[model samples]
Target chain A: MHILLVEDDLQLGSAIQRALERLAYTVTWLRDGQSAIAGLADGSADLVLLDLGLPRRDGLEVLREARRQKVATPVIVMTARDSVEARVSGLDAGADDYLVKPFHLDELAARIRSVTRRHHGVAANRLEVGTISMDLATAEVSYRGERLELTRREFALLQALMERAGHIVRREALENSIYGLDTVVGRGALEVLMHSLRRKLGADAVQTVRGFGYMMPREPA
Target chain B: MHILLVEDDLQLGSAIQRALERLAYTVTWLRDGQSAIAGLADGSADLVLLDLGLPRRDGLEVLREARRQKVATPVIVMTARDSVEARVSGLDAGADDYLVKPFHLDELAARIRSVTRRHHGVAANRLEVGTISMDLATAEVSYRGERLELTRREFALLQALMERAGHIVRREALENSIYGLDTVVGRGALEVLMHSLRRKLGADAVQTVRGFGYMMPREPA
Candidate 1:
């Protein structure tokens, strides 16, 4: 998951970024609300962890402006105020969830899951797309109710596509999803993974845009 | 899943809310950071959809405040602006994933799933508690990885218990999880389902928590 963390304290931001990254999440950190607003405008973050105290523009102003412009992403408000009025006011103003200062990261993670689950509905452990389903725990995929055996590389490739299915995934993004930011894969590996997936899931399951990337088409109605 | 959506534009907010509900997600829409923060403080919403723009509180200030107080619920920022600087800034401030506006709701759904997966580390589609693994899709229970057939109601009851293995699940929560809010179930039904689950899984699979609900023990490590 890609996350935008808006925190001004360098130490706190770095710590949270590192922790989230260690859990395999891609994190982008900003030090102020102006940048946070700018980032919200740009569009790529799956979620926002908004800090109220920010330089340049206040976090609340950024949120207000974002909503005025019809940005519909979810935001969790974080602050030092533990008063009931503050909480009530924050929720009233469009913050999704409110957390007082000095809470546990694990609890934070739990809240994140809860909010995401609420947003997506049915927060299950597996991802089901059409006839294909991927189990995050086992990293296994089953197509048409039958398990389709996949190699490590092939599975990783499919997983990336499945994660971002329906969108016209950029070639570079696909490569990065499977090979990581620092690693370079050999030529034809993506093609090979696609070939294997097609052979297993029937040729029409995945669509290649050529020069762009791939998209796992949704099942016909 | 309980979601708090903080978008100010009434038309867009209502539209997105309807769309999300159509996808079966339970959502509460707020117009500003103050309300958003209040919802989170109450611990009602599981995840938040935050807009960077608002009337009073901006998205970044909300996030900064929430973070300062240590609210850990996940936030996804959505906006119409597109800029690398905005992306960097939002990430720096504490947004999970930034998504630009004018995006397909389907893509937003996938992004929600992606963020949830990253935040929660993926829950098992089939939960294994003690010797039983409950398959949520098929509503089948497996003992020692061997399939154990069960009736629909029995399967539902077992699914609820296994979801929060190692923790006591209140009777009301279990009832709501299995039976809809409008539906009424008999006390005997719960007992019968428990009997069937125990018969299939094991005698010790579920333990009755007096006056509260039931507890499903975790698998021995």
Candidate 2:
């Protein structure tokens, strides 16, 4: 996912940019509110981490103007304003979520999860297919009673399939999700990864639909 | 939704362009494959309608190049070649759907709906909350077995709410969905439209969450 981070604090901004990059998210960090407004209106941001305090303009004003102009990108306000009135005003001004500063990276990740899940029109952080559960908050997967250990590529593959849950997910879509657009991946790399994944679970965990894609049954057979 | 149209036939291209615009879809119409490739790579189109017979480049070549470059936009191939092999090849080259020539406008609309639904990581075209059912193919809504009367804005609003059924869809998000990002809408227009929709569906159909937005129950109250 691509994130637009708006913060002028060098220390906190660098920390967040680094953390998000570590999580494999593409981050574009801007140090002022004017750029933040333009970024939000440009229609590329999957989500925005906005700060209420900024150098050029107020963050609330940026958000308000964006919303008034019908920019619908999900925004999580990360700021030091912890008052109840401030949070209420933030939400009223079209922030999708409000996060007080001095927070842990884990909490930030979890909030990103919840906000994005809702942004995708799913109500909760959990995506379930049969006995396999994907916890978006922790980025964890468990099958039956055991935690399913997966590599980053495997996790991306699983996420792509499980997001659709019970359908034949297109192979091209899976490749784009796992390897990302513009990433050079070798031929048969996906098959090799799928082999390892199926071996980790069972052969029936994901079924290949010949010439089409792959499907995971809503119920494991 | 924004559509990228690639077709060389002036008659068919003009008809489709007009029809899509009438349906409220923004279309960037291209007369050949080279521009289609560039348009697909630009990432603005939500969907692409590609004609297999093109001027400068073969449609399959365009599709193949775009897919090779990892452009993941959903595309429906419109072609006069109706052979099973041609259809299979189109799908293999990453076309999301195939439409043979002499297709009705209704059929084209249905294909667009299905392709877009799957592109959004959803397997089905039906969104049901409570007794209200929204049919993507027909763009129709039925509440309690009775057809609901909705204007375009009202339909857009209902579709937005029903897409995120059972959750409090933010007011700003709803406004963006009902009115396009570049549209100029008056303040309280959403409220006025929502009131009329509720009047038609029933007062209890949608409930407001104060200081937040609106929620429609999974089961009607």
Candidate 3:
């Protein structure tokens, strides 16, 4: 997941950045509201962690502008300003969730998961296709009552494919999910990953859409 | 971004999880070596933040198992075992980076960014196509010297399209980038976003590939 973290506190921002990276998230940290708004306009982040008090532009204004411009990425407000009025206003401004300062990290993680899950229309953390079942929360994949041993990249690739089962997944999208978006992947890197996945899961597991991408058939052929 | 955090200490794990979430990372926190191994096997995380003195299975053993299984996700070892020998062994055991428990969070964030960047083969933080230019670091986009305002979703979609300029971006792929893999987006949501983008960037900025997807012509047709 990619996150846009907007905060002015150097100490807090740095700490949050480290913590998020430790949890395996790619974060783009901006210290001011103007940049935060600019960042949102470009759509590089999966979600935004917005702080209300910011330099150049207020966080609330940024949120308002984003909504005005129809930027639909979910936003979760995290600030020291903790009041029912503030929370209501933030939510009214289109913030998907709110977190007060000095809050537990687990709570933030849960809210992030919840908002994102709601955005994706995933009611649960589990996804299943055919005999392949995956628990997003546990990061476990079992095929036909037997667990499948896959590498991190392989598991990520399989999850991406299986999530959209019966629909073709563009190669570019698959590559982005497996590797960070900024990375310049070699031409054959994806093919190599796909080949490995096929070797383990059987050739009929993933279908290529010729010039486009790959798909996990609803009924594996 | 998705992270697999392997740490046995409850307080430390909780702290780390909070910090990461503030930075907008989606973290899967595991307290033991066995669950860490299982998590890695599914390939759900983009990277792993591993601790050596883990309960159940040693952190080093988890790393070794991941490597043996060809789980190539980058692993950053963070532990209190601060010895040259321990660091060397951790590196030898396939750790991409190492940090002491008393290390600065800022330093950890920088190292995580550095390791992930290297893994992704990203040498620079800027991407450009035609008159549209993007600074990946700042998440800024400009067209013909004019700063173009884009929503977070729009920016993501544009980045994906511009990155593969001249190639047809599969609709499925574009949708995945804009919304997320599991999001059951309304049929016209993408069209609406694209329409807005076209209005802002001019109709010629993006081209639909009929039944396939959309493309940004290399020559800007």
Best by DockQ: 1
Off by over 4 Å in 3: A7-31, A149-152, A179-181, B1-221
Q: Which digits, one per residue and each the tens of the lDDT, describe model 1 over residues A1-221?
A: 45678889888788887776554455667777766765665455566788877888787887876665455567888888788987787777677887787777776776665666577677634778898998744557898899878866667667667766665566656665555422446768778878987888888888766545677865532
True contacts kept of 1: 0.07
Query: Using TM-score as the measure, what is the rank order of every candidate, best first?
Result: 3, 2, 1
Model 3: residue B207 alpha-carbon error in angstroms: 22
TM-score of chain B of 3: 0.56
lDDT (CA) per prediction = 0.70, 0.78, 0.77
Q: Over 4 Å off in model 2, which ranges? A: A1-14, A21-47, A53-62, A65-73, A80-86, A113-127, A135-138, A168-196, A208-214, B1-221
Task: Kindly list the per-residue Cα lDDT of model 1 for residues B1-221, writing each as its tens digit.
Answer: 88889999897788778767655689999998888778877777767888888878988777777766777677788777776556555555667677777665544665676566555556344567766766442244578878665665676677666656788877766665556434578877677767877787667767878998888878553
Candidates' DockQ values? 0.04, 0.03, 0.02
At residue A21, candidate 3 shows an lDDT of 56
Q: Write the per-residue lDDT of candidate 3 for residues A1-221, one digit (tens) a residue.
A: 56788999999998887776555455667788756765665444678999899987799998997776567899999878879998999999999999999878777777877887898897646778888887755567788888878777787788778767876676766765565433556879999999998888888889776655787988857
